[model samples]
Target: MNKLNIDSLNFYFSKSTDVNDICVKLKSFQKKSHQLYKAHKHREAKQIALAYLELTDSLITKNNDDNCLLENRILFLNRLCELEKNHENYDKAYHYLIQIEKTINDKPVKDKINFQHQLQNSLNKAVIKNHLNMPQKAIEIAKETFKENISSIYYDKNSIESLSLEADITKTLADSYILLGKELNNASYLDSAFYFYHKSYDAAKIYDSSAKSAAFKHNIAMTDVLMARKDYKGAINSINNYKNTANSFDYKHHEYMNKAICYHALKNSDSAMYFAKKLIHNKKDKCRRSNLITLYNILSKEYFNLNEIDSAYKYSKLEITSFEKARKNKEKTFQLLYNNDFAEAKKLNSQIIKQENVNDKNKLIYIFSIIIILLLTYLYLVSKKKETNQIILDLKNNNVVEKTEKVAYNINEDFEAEILTAINLMEQQDAYLQADFSINKIAEKLETNSTYISFVFNKHKQETFKQYFTKKKISYIIDKLNTDTTYRKYSIQALAEEIGYGSSSAFTRAFKKQMNVTPSAYIKSLSK
Candidate 1:
């Protein structure tokens, strides 16, 4: 990575969603992981973790939360887990998991979830390795790193950040424990793994992250994958969902691996060689390196499939080189991230300590006074300004106006109609009637800036928004006066209400304010 590209400054300090840049930062973090693990470097690691989390939070939160940023999402998650693991921060993990699970529940990004799951699985395997006696499987699992995070773009609410939080990773963690239990030959370890997995799963299940698909479909897909793993031909029937999903490559790897194993069982050298070669080439990361190498031991298998002994021998020689290269790359990336993370952590701690000791009361007072002056100036100009669509947008700061979940309007429709339509929609929501239903509130609903809404309203409406919006309410009152006798049933106070009014006195005040007459007088005019 270029030195300029990789930043050790910390996550929140850098506000970018560039995955490559994030990856570079993560690589730097990985470089420091080891040094930070040492006794002296512990504070350093803690600081790096703090800085990493701050960035994670800042990145996750945006003016408009767009979770389509798959890599950033994954990196945030990955770093969170790594930080928690080093610190034994189950509470922090729980918090992070809450955010992740909420995203998972809210969005339907299958590809992104798969990447998340892969990282999680790697973590599960790592934790279980020390406790379990399955050295072989643990070593085999270690090879399954470097899975790139993928994003799944579904419908509007399908983005993770847009969703409400629900925690489900606990179940995934539990499942990993169950698998670990089976791998453990010792019954005691099995029980321990079972208890842990059960606890995790129970907590996770409390979370409800429903896919748009039905619960039955989830069961069916899960069952099919499990069943397919049992019978090769059965997999041919059951594995289509598994084979075609975002995790298809994983299924394909297993399929080819199974075919190779079956061919070997049947002593069919010709068939085994074809599947074996395909496995190494296409499903490179899926199969075990030892099993991959053993294929070369079968001199007869290679010749039969390729129709040339020499070709078989060439592939056999290539496997070791490929494995070694992959291993070296992992080592290099891991080391780089570890070193950077350690250094940044130490720097971060020093900075935080320095900041804690410092005070700036005089400077703060000066800043506050400036802010107050600026605010008063802003309010005065706004109230005094001529009201137009532009003025309205400006008054409300564009974003504070009422909004619909309106897809962004096109360039062609820049008129009063659009603003009217938006206002009407908000009115329909009874937003205008609410006490909190100010221009700012509306702009927030529309996800635009308050100033921009005021601009549009002022430019097109030709009247100040306050006056215009009041006119609309006055018009509504007139409509009620003409159409609804329900207004007459009340006293001047009651009559004010048949339409929308907070209080009888407010109605009288507004009626006189708008019509220059009381509600009682307006009724007498109608009688005449």
Candidate 2:
């Protein structure tokens, strides 16, 4: 079971349509299937469960209630229960568990021979009740199960399986308490939730396997509870306390995201962005869409607050895209559960079969459409880049000319020389190396109106105030990078800070525009 590779089963099941084909494949891959189910790959687990049910329906007529066949039905039913519960389809989960209960009753197994199976049946029932928002009912059933299985307390805690069962029971109780707390809006109930969650963590920590994975998740839930109470600092403390344990279980991404949310709630945008960036950098397709949406929103707002419009727009687009996709997936899941019955799922699958050819044709059309869009986007970007390059070249070659327009301000040659001298003095002193430097600030220092300053730059320098200021700052940074070895070793953010460019991305864009290469590329060429 430990050596099973569920991921490889995907290849064999890729185009399977017939129940018999799916059943044969699943039978050979049962161990891997369970492993996948435990890892929360719910879609794959659901497919296997449905295929098993279809095969069982076809075989039960001939087998006449074979114990092995019935057992397989029960296994898939429990997996279905878990899958439905995870999708928040509580009624569907309850239906699956009710079927499990009926199957177990018909089998009439002795407790000594099937204690674990019976225990799981009871636990699944309680979990579904909890998810249905009946916390008291869930707790009542959970306590009854504990009373019935008191002997489990004497079981070996060092065994991973035994610890996992204990952890499951404790986590369920914790969840029940948490739900009750939310329903009643009672703070005291949270104390009980924490107590049981910690107990679950302790039990799970006894083994370095799936049990420990549960521990990390439970610890993170505790932080969520703190966050719900508006205790952002407490949430941060919990995260720090569990950081080492989290890293050991590949939970570092979750930790970083939770920390980012807590910091965002505290209005610490800089700290929030740091953790958000950490989460985004290592994100994978398997990452939850909800988390990705939240991270993107955080980044967008943080950058907007910092006055980095380009960065803000970039993340805002990502947030909107991911959010729409997430919403679509949610809709599909809701549609699947609209009937809340296995027969409806089978009927849906039959409809899918009837529509397969049409779907395939639509898929081909989608693929071709995507290809055309990507090609056009590439061409458009290339054209835009060329246009930007030409503009930069013109700026550098002194070929830029202001459009001729009548103005009442007569440009005296003497006044023009004074303005140019003042600009030169400011440039020599590196006055542009300030985050808030603007034409208005410059006008105040030069004892003139901002319009007059803008007029001087546009008429004499042949550039807007912003363009000339950016050029001067970028030029200064380029000189430092070429001559100062220590400055060259600085990170993009550090260099941006030293040169007062507001942000590294802004600095990078300006450098590329003026020098026809990125700052990093320019530094690399210097090394060459």
Candidate 3:
């Protein structure tokens, strides 16, 4: 074993005179390792932790009778786990967690200490699984651990240890739920996440750890900012308020990330890019793979916005590489676990086969369902084609007005007529040609609220404001296509942009809906 060169850790590799001496040295080494970790000297901290682990293992081997050494071994393993997890070396971290679990299981369940160790081990495993992107498995582990031990742990909530444990478990549950919700796009799962996060906050408060409470509180506020409310400014305010309270490297890193996300959402790309680059370039702190991916994506987008094609492409490639590395790491860790447990692997294989059989049945049903829907859509489009052709003929003949039966509105007829006239004047001026045009803008020009304009649109035009606006834009574009040969020569993208649509796909969808044929096909027919 190599000596770490620190005065405290130097004795780690040397032969000790007695078990007591070794135990004292181990304590010193553990304390020094924690101090190094808190100081952000992760490499030195890991070295010290590994040395402690080796020393403890050898001591345990020579003196299996000492329960103290066995407990110290678990501590060393947990230290290594924390170190590895901090650096995003999740496979190594998971290996250490598994060692902790085996160590705990080998011991006879005698006291609350062993039970606490077991619960902590389970929490660590769930956290590692979550980091590995197996959030459902994380959730299952957390749920099972809690369900199996709630009676024992719940009764002692007044104890700091119990409260801390509860906070950790609930926080893990919330983290898992957040990941699951994002993966599945389920609001209910996100709501469950918030509930658990609040529970975590409550527990942490009683645990009397300001850092822990602040962390959970930050989680809730950030979740609301990012997922639920999407209040970007509010997110920035929350992050700024709590940033000084971030005691750990993880929370500090999150502060940077959340700031970048909020700035990006607010269209402050420069600020976003600066913070993103700050996090990426910080050598003392390693970013999580997911955060690395997000930062790369932000940098790529910002560079693209500046028209720096090379820089954008560079970060885009980096984003993809980071994503692939994360995915492969998860697979590798999962395979490591699978290879370690043959019976579990066999069971998983059986389940996979059953799932495949069910999927095959579902595939056939989906294919038939798609075919039926396509046939119905085809018939609908055929009828719509006739209607569109008639409208196009009328446009060519300068007879484009279509009448709708007037509907009663709560607003007086004079007010309704005035709103209609304002809308017609805006349409005549081709105000919809602006890409940012909206009902609100029209309402502003008319000195009226959007609600009244929306009411008039719904009641008079028999369509919502959006639908009416889309029809007018499409109708104007169709008229241009009929009258202007130059319009037919433009590419689909150019045509879309000419009519204030952001992308060709959006234009094509709207054109197809209006004309029952794609813009490209319609243009080709006009050319013929």
Candidate 4:
């Protein structure tokens, strides 16, 4: 199949004046975009769909009374929503879904075709909501859509399209139910989830969609693994069974991750580490942030169990970084939804006033409620900023340095000298650069106990072991950041990793406590 060229599309759209010719071109573009999407060329498909939307918007504005053009506009929006949802760009998907909902609402459902379009819109909304973790709302929408589908199927029995819709709706219900069950720990909800999963699988088989059948089958197996908490052996068997049919990247990732979890639970550290490392080395780029976090955590624990302190610390830091990324993504999604909701509220308020049907008392209450919400949001942000500022101020005022005066201890002078010499040797070797370097490790190296090392530090060094260790590490990093231009070029995460810190935030806190400035500020000062 020939791909749609953007240049040719733009040129033809610009030159064409005939409505019939333009509509035909748009239909052709739609088919091409769908074909690319089916072929898994999502990026290309999105580009074509976006171009189609832009062209359709222009045509609709010029021909506002044309129902055909309006219907095509809805189709374009729906396609964009599907593309964004598949990419896990939930914010963009929700935006397109809102547009689709508004378009469908503006036109009455005059035929079975329009009713199907409305059902599709509802299904997309429910799926997006579920992805955003609003499972209850998702379930409500899915159930409503399922009821509509059943009604349509009663009249149009033996319709393959109806079976396809049934499969999609039930699968959505299963997913939402699972999420709700996990959140609330409700056994009934889990049972309902399994029921819907089986229903979805049966419908997919009847619809002759092998891909959908395989996907629902994987879902069932994974759910079984998750619920079999103490039965690691059973979980392993389920994962092995699913592995035979796991052709997609996501399915295979789940298979490996579950296997690693089961083996780790079974006390097979080597096998667990092998599978976890395989995931990282083979599919790191393609893996989701959450999956990377899980893999890193598994590897960290396995290495810790094997007494490989350095490897354990490295993977722990990676897990922390992945967790931070996932948190930021969630925050971004929430911010997008918050902004959209606020705008929608304003739009609804305007429509109510324009209609002039609402009484003044009710209008006052509605407006007042919106004002209160805005005020609360503003106050929450201000309070968060104040808390952060107070933390920085406290850190700046607190002294981390050891006192000059030290008290005498009853311990033998010869043993104190031996501990001091061991510490000096370790310092000279730069052993503190290891993240897991601690009093216990030093004691093990010196063939002594941690109590003796702690005693020496407290009685002679005038500081605790942790304080002394942190001071050494932070001081070294400070000197490097000042003199090494290459160090200044690194990101905070890279800088933290360089000094064996598990998280950038922890490094930032230490830097702030030591230098009374954040790492970024210190780096900026070096540039100046």
| Cα displacement (Å) at residue 317, model 4 | 2.7
Q: Candidate 3: where are CA atoms >4 Å away?
A: 1-20, 153-155, 209-225, 247-252, 323-528
**Residue 262 in model 3: shift from native, Å?**
2.7
Which numbered prediction scores highest in lDDT against the true structure? 3
Against the true structure, candidate 1 reaches a TM-score of 0.27
RMSD of each: 32.1, 19.7, 18.6, 19.8
Q: In TM-score terms, which candidate is top?
A: 3
Candidate 1 per-residue C-alpha lDDT over 1-528 given as tens digits, one digit per residue, 9 for 90 to 100: 222222443342343334566545654554444235432355566576557646645755652244444334444555555555444343455456555545544444556455555445454444434223344454344334322212234222334422311112323333444454444534454354334334433333343443322232332334333332333345344434544443212345555555665556556675675677566645335444435644543432344243332333344334444344434543433332234433443343344334423424554878899999999999987787766457677867746666566343343355435555777798775455443456786577666666666766666677766777666666776777788765544455334433446467777877789999887888788767
Mind sharing the TM-score for model 4? Answer: 0.55
Question: How many clashes in each structure?
Answer: 54, 0, 0, 0
lDDT by residue (253-340, candidate 4, tens digit) is 6666777878988989978976786667563335655567667777766765664444555666566555555456656774533344
What C-alpha lDDT do the candidate models reach, one value each? 0.49, 0.71, 0.74, 0.72
How much is the lDDT of residue 71 in candidate 3?
78
Regarding TM-score, does 1 or 2 come out ahead?
2
Task: State TM-scores per candidate.
Answer: 0.27, 0.51, 0.56, 0.55
